[model samples]
Target: MTGEVAGGRVPLPQRTAEARLIVVARAKRAEDYDRVLDVLVEAGIRSIELTLTTPGTFERLPALTDRYGASVDLGVGTVTSEAELARAIGAGARYIVTPVTSAALVAQAREAAVPIVPGGLTPTELFASWSAGASAVKIFPAGQVGASYLKDLRGPFPDLVAVPSGGVDLDGAAAWLAAGAAAVSVGGPLLGDAFAGGDLAALGTRAEAFVSLCARTAH
Candidate 1:
């Protein structure tokens, strides 16, 4: 599906197709978040997910879009309400991600023609989200289930595009991809305690590593 925006039309599937890794950034301060984002973008990580939990995220969305939207497919995550969904779209988010499967939100995204990746852990929830027209289904806290879970899920629903988020590090990212995950969403592992006064350079190196891993193992 396509939706018209300031830049032009946005094709939902195409947007999801281009993202191999989505960096989830949540910082107490916007400046720190920006710093990490710069490092990630410089390391060739083009997709970013700014969580609503971050302070000033909604207020800063427009500026973020203006500055990096051209090169990065910026999106909003941890969304749970229609209001948040609306605000994200207005902020020019290329995609929407939720922590749980919300059929209503999925329908709203479908209407707007924006890609939505709703979180689900069970087969029922995942299938429901996909059936509701979500561009992809995100398996939250995937570390607990591991790559084996994803591979098993594909047995019943081979067509489902599964994205594993939370607790996913560079070491397991390729394994998830090999298990048939459409893409992987990484957070603290890639950030490397940067928000806790760690070195941004370390984060940059980690970003490069993740990007290279994705390249080598992309499905």
Candidate 2:
């Protein structure tokens, strides 16, 4: 089940399928990024994504990685360029996720040996991303598509590892899992500003709720 990537050998799919809880924090300041990551780690959200929206994202990413990379699956989202990809990798990004699929970026991630989860909407986009070597396809704004859509989608593309992103919540997580999603990525809707605003206890509570729901559905 283990596969080799550019960075190193990634564990088998079974091990990676811990019903991920990816917290994507958006901000225009490094302080915000710090707050979100700190809370996420404390709340036990081991996988975190720092979207490239903050002014000092590049500088902050490495610092965060240096501090937490050993225990966290730190990654970057909304990545668009080869330079940005390199920067994220240098900063110790364990994975690369994008809002849109790009052949060049996917290729670079492959070279770096990091799993790339590129964004795709329609069936065409999903398959295209898979064909381009994407490890998983993120269905951005998946709220509009709904869990039933995934159920129907997997019927045809059974091997596709779909990750529904944007607007996913605890109550709805099970539906997505039952629909056959490999994992789910939630943003503000799950890890609200309270968590991003320095509320560790609240974040931890929310993390537990999310994990509970995902675990329940996974079985």
Task: Indicate which candidate wins on lDDT.
Answer: 1
Model 2 over residues 61-157: C-alpha lDDT tens digits?
8788787777677778889888888888777777888998787787777766677888988998888887777778899889898999888887778
Task: Give every collision pair in model 2.
Answer: 5-113, 6-113, 7-113
Instruction: Show where candidate 1 strays beyond 4 Å.
Output: 1-16
Task: Report the lDDT tens digits of candidate 1 across residue range 6-38.
Answer: 232233444345658988998886666676777
RMSD to the hidden true structure, all candidates: 3.3, 3.2
Off by over 4 Å in 2: 1-3, 6-16, 195-199
- Per-residue lDDT for 176 in model 2? 83
